[model samples]
Target: MKSVFRKILLLFITVCTLFVVLKWDLIRYGWQQARGQIAIMYNAEPLAHFLENPSYPDSLKAKIKLVEKVKTFANAELGFSSESQYEKMFDQKGKELMWVVTAALPYSLESYKWNFPVLGEVSYKGFFIEKEAIKLAQQLTKKGYDVRVRTASAWSTLGWLNDPLLSNVLNLSNGRLAELILHELTHDEIFIKDSIEFNENLASFFGQEFTKKFFKKQLERYASELYDYLLHLEDRHTLNKFVRNYLPRFDSLYQKIEGLSTIEKENQKFYLIEKFKQDLRNQKFKNPKYTDFIKSEIDVNNAFLLSYKRYSGHQELLERKLQTQFDGDIGKMLDFYQKNYDSL
Candidate 1:
């Protein structure tokens, strides 16, 4: 019996050793990233540090005050997690915090996923450097993957790490800044693993609603910002509706075209894509940004839509549910989802 137990322990150790050897690079990269972030946190000065500085301009002070106000409101009014982040600030000196790289098959909406320890699987990967992300994107493109890299001004570690405010977005408009702060906080407060779409969409919904409510309290002062935000939401909703309706059509084309010869299917897909773009061009969005986005988006592969879809797909239905069932109270909506997102 003791011999058998020794054999089992030896085998387990062997397996662990092999796993470590196989994943050494991944482990090293993750550790490097974690250490870098930890260093930043260690060096980051608390908000009080800056406030006490004589060189801190009034404009910067006001911005920090607004962030504090938003944080207070998120806790006292919205009933989001009482857990706190955004307690410190890191100025990255005109650089984005990270760049996100997303890849997909040329003709499929499914994204290439990367699995990391603790984080599980995520559809997109973030690199602290731009050239590295571009290189990876180019490599994936060469392998026939539709790849995209976008600058990410901010992101959350889902409470695993202290995410500090960075200089990259310090110049954001007051409304946008508040929205971003609220959005990131929501992620810190509650997150589901291996669910990028759900996480992003929920955060975005809160950001929009919170900003609107925040601005509405001072409508006389925020009228223009509020108007612009509403118009953007209207445009986004229209775009989401258009995409959701067309998604099935795209799926059908993929299915039906498979029966055709490869050459013929390729030709048909091209024609369909062009048709999709032409149809989207005619959409009457309240904000021209949506029109321009569709134009740029159609030029890329189906994978181009993955992240956008994750963040906005079926958002109109969600908005309606919030209004009809939750009485548009974000706290109630959040509570319902907190208890029910898995079923969803």
Candidate 2:
């Protein structure tokens, strides 16, 4: 019996060693992510603690209260699950918490995807360490893929962990803050595997719709603010339309260059992209808020354009469904989607 037990222990140790050897990269990445998440959770303090701390500013306290109001509205009215989210806060202390990297074929709109265990396939990879994200982006660029790296304001853990409100976001205006919170809550309520575009579009649609309702409920107090926000939404809508209109043209251009050399194809791609940026700059918008945004797209590539498409592609269809099928009832639409996400 002693000899048998010793043999079994040796086999167990060997198996674990083999597993570690086989999955070192994944294990290391998982450890990095887990460590970052744990650090945030450990540093977070309950909302009450901050509210009661006299050293905390009144302005920040007001934002904290606003966060609570947004969460309550999302739960009671928009039918999103709270699940203890936003009950605590993490101070980013002026640093970005995460960076997301997206990649695409230089000559095509096809997004490069990353597969994880439970989340399945996702088009973007997130890194808690900025240098890690930049390293991946550099590697992808060397591999001839168009890559874009941007700071992420927030992301859902899909209910795996209670997400805390980051201190950096408290600088957003009330309406913008409400939109951000509602957007994340939508993810908590409904997520479909391997359908990132649909998930993001659904969240954005609900975030905008619910924010409108949230402001409309207190129109007397936020009428001007609501009006300005609506104009901002209009600018975004116009931009989405502009991008949608150009997608087919981009596809056509790519198809036209099928037989060209790689260098020639890249040249043509940038030429067209430059032309598109110029046209975008020439367009009239409802607000001047996007002037700097338009200028930033001068370096736009397939990855950047496709990233925008992921969030806005299905928005019109969702809006039509909301108005026609759900009679503009956001909650009912949410319920239908939540019940039928697998089919979607």
Candidate 3:
């Protein structure tokens, strides 16, 4: 029995050693992410603490109260999870928490996916260290992948850890703040494995729809807020329409250039991208919000375009289905997907 036990222990040690040797990069990346998550969890304080703290600013406290109301509304009215998420606050102290890196083929809309332990396959990866994200982007770019790196203010743990309301989120307008809270909560409600685009679109749809309902119920007092939110929605609609109309043109451009040299293809790709930006500049918007967004906010590469599609591609379809088939019942629409996602 002693000899058998010793052999098993030796085998286990050897296997672990081999895994570390072969997957050192993955281990390192996971360790960085774990450290970042652990830091946030450790620093988080319960909402009651901040609400009761005399030294805390009244303005921030009010935002905290608004968050509490939003969470309750999402749970009691919208049928999202009643988990302990957003019950705590994480003060970022004006520093970004994570940077997300997304990559795609330069000539096609296909995303460059990374396979992980539990997430299976994902199109984007997050880094706690910005430099590390930049390093990865450089490497992918060298390999001819179009890479986009952007800062993320909030994320969900899928109930694994109680997510905290980030301080930056409090700075958004009242309507946007509510939407952001509901959007993250939607992840807790349902997440389909390996289908990042579908999961994101579902969350976006519910988030926007729930926000509309919340403001509508309070419109007597929040009329101005609702108007502002509607304007924001209109701008979003305009951007979505632009992308929907132009993405096919991009696809056609790529298809026609299949026989071109790599350098030649890259030149043409960027030329077309500049033309797209010019067209965006020429269009009149309902608000000045997208002017800066078009000029400098985004890199407007294949990865960026696909990122928009990932979040909003199926929104109209989902909205139509909700109205026509589900009788405009968001709860029933959610139930159908929760039960039928695998088949989808």
Candidate 4:
């Protein structure tokens, strides 16, 4: 009995050691990310201090105040959390906290998901270092994934940590700043696990609508910036509409191409991309931003579509539903999303 007990003990310890050894990389990733979040939570300084700094630029000071205003309005008018998240701010000293890498197959719209603790399977992975993000992209690229890396200006911890307005977005127009603040706040309001698409799209929906109303309410104060934002939004709408029509058609065509050799498929793909670019160029947009976009080489792949779709998919249908059924009331829309969150 003593010999059996000893053997069992040895086996258990060996198994445990092997498990830890095998999972060390995953463990380190989770630990480092959690530590980074905790550090940010602790490093944040009160917004009042930043405002009181006489040496700070007047423009940035006003943007910081705008953060508070948006947070207050979200709490009082939009019924979002009255948490003390936006009470503090952090200046990253030109260092970004993370880069988001989104990956998807070349032919499918499904995002390549990475499973992490707490957040579950997220469609995009955030790396504290750009090199790490690039490493991931390279891995995904090796697997035939089309990956896109975007520098994140800000992110919320879903009420788990104090989210601060970063210095990265201090230069955005007042209207754009408010839009970003509301966007992050909405994430805290209704970020369901395993429903990032719903969470982001819902946030984008509220962000745009709430910005329209928020700026309209203060239009007299921010008229010029409001015009800039409105024009920006108009271009965004136009671009989204074009993407919605073109990509699905492109995907359909790609699927229908039978007996095409690998080289032929490559040629067809480039042809489609060029044609889409031409179509975008044909449509004249007032925003120079959109004009610049059409001039670039736009790659249409699963990653491209997946990333865009998360923030803007079903937007037209959703807006129509809210406008027609909910009478365009923002509160009603929030209530509807909460009730039918999963279905979305």
Candidate 5:
């Protein structure tokens, strides 16, 4: 019996060792692929492609124009932020490498057998292959979650979830790449496990706020375009509010449909979706080219997604409270968020 136990232990260790070794190669390949992909995207699109996408929502396209104007303004009039000097830091300095940019997926039967080297198991509706991400958006919509799904050739890993297998940084448009790197690095600087909502909200808040400073300093050159840039900001705020309002209704509808019979659920779901479109149409957000909510497959339980989306809305409120109580600094904010979140 003792001998058998020893053998089992030895086998377990051997398997673990093999797994680690295999993962090392995967990590290497993933980084290489990620780098290569970023280079290719940059080469093909040249940053201008995203701007020229005829399908890009006018609101967002306007934002991109602002970014360019900001860059020009900064260089010409405002005098560049010495910080922009660090822009090159996020790029692949040597050979174009490769890495995976992935997201945790809602549970599905269609699991990929492959592991992402340092990142562990690959899940469905995740962002490894971008098409799958689009599919995921559609699926999540059917499940009654409101989301705006956009694809980009570049993304960042933020410091917290450093999976060596995925891309550390991507070659993106100057404005976009900067945002991705800052956002990802913010995660690396401070991350809380199982609190993706808090993590993302903080990163997003800081990233945007910081970008405002960055662009403000950079756009000194393009004073004439500053008003146009501000318009983009106004549009973003509008869009964000729109998304927040829609999410709650979608969440309520999802809960209502969860236990219904198949036919009943379908009938109700279609009704809700048509209503949803009508709401968007009423709000002037119904861009036919961009709006697609196909009923392909629906797994009704979406507590994870609901919680994440809902939490983002509340995080700011919580953060503001913390700021009032303890002044606006990161450490205090984190403590309050963690303590409050756990208590809930």
Candidate 6:
């Protein structure tokens, strides 16, 4: 009996070790595959044609131009490293991950098509799986929005998956991308789990202010191109609009929820979740009646929803402190954030 038990224990240990070994390789391969595909699609002629084609809407073309500008600024100004540098940063083995770019053509003004790049799927959980963002892009395609999307396992999603998550960067402009890269890199510098609001708020505050300083420095060298640069600033305007519109309502709902009893709270939670759709409908953000999914998706009032709210709220205060205390020095701003280490 003792001999038999020892044999079983040895087998279990061996299997567990094997699983760990396999999972690491799987993650690495997925990252590499995603990276390679992005590089290839960006360089492909078909994509180039689609990007330049005049038939595409002028606004989208402008956004694409913005993307190019952002990438240039990100690579040139922000600390975005070369492919080799990325490999070194991640301790990669120099294997390139392929990213599948999906640029949807409009079937109509209300609808768009999805284009999946060749060789796009990556290994996840021991199986080859299509990326979730690609899936979302496809679904939106069916609903109609002139969606041009892409799929990559390795490219950063700017920590939107975590609480206090960064608002997603769905087909964002260059200015947006630069901010995202900074925010995510900051996470590597400091992270506190289950505090999504604090994490994201810190990142958002850090990234936005950091990028401004970064751009200011770049502007000194390229003084003639300031107008094109300010176009990116318009993105922050849009973000502020989004925050102002949503934050008040979210706070009101949170206060209401706080006053309710446990049973009442849960019941109210369900009711409010449903009512969020109506609120969105009333605001004309979208037609609530048009989707197969509604109640499950409308979570604007969730406690976790406003992880970044506190930080976003105190942003001006923090900025004021930085300016008053440090005379708007970028290095000092970095040091202050790093030292204070509070969520807001």
Instruction: Estimate every model's Cα lDDT from 0 to 1.
Output: 0.77, 0.87, 0.86, 0.80, 0.46, 0.46
Output the worst ten-in-a-row residue range by lDDT, candidate 2.
Answer: 290-299
What digit string (tens of lDDT, one per residue) describes model 1 on residues 1-344?
Answer: 99999999999999999998999978766875677678667777788887788998778877887788788878777775534578888877676768888998766567888887666788888777677788888988899887888888787876666678776566876877888988888787667778878788888888888888877876897798788877877787777677667777767887787667868877887887787778878889866667677667544556666766878874777789899999988778878876775421
Best by TM-score: 3
Q: Each model's number of backbone clashes?
A: 0, 0, 0, 0, 24, 15
* lDDT value, residue 116 of candidate 4: 69
Where model 6 places Cα greater than 4 Å from the true spot, the runs are: 1-172, 220-314, 339-344
What is the per-residue lDDT of model 2 for residues 233-341, given as tens digits with 9 covering 90 to 100?
8988999989888998899999999999989998998889888998998877866668777866466888988977999998889999999999998878988988877
TM-score of each: 0.84, 0.93, 0.94, 0.90, 0.50, 0.42
Off by over 4 Å in 4: 1-22, 297-300, 339-344
Return the candidate ranking by TM-score, descending. 3, 2, 4, 1, 5, 6
lDDT of 4 by residue, 120-162 (tens): 7789888777787898899889988778988888888776667
- The CA root-mean-square deviation of candidate 4, after full C-alpha superposition on the true structure, stands at 2.8
Worst lDDT 10-window in candidate 3: 289-298
Q: lDDT, candidate 5, residue 175?
A: 45
RMSD of 2: 2.1
Which has the higher TM-score value, candidate number 4 or candidate number 5? Answer: 4
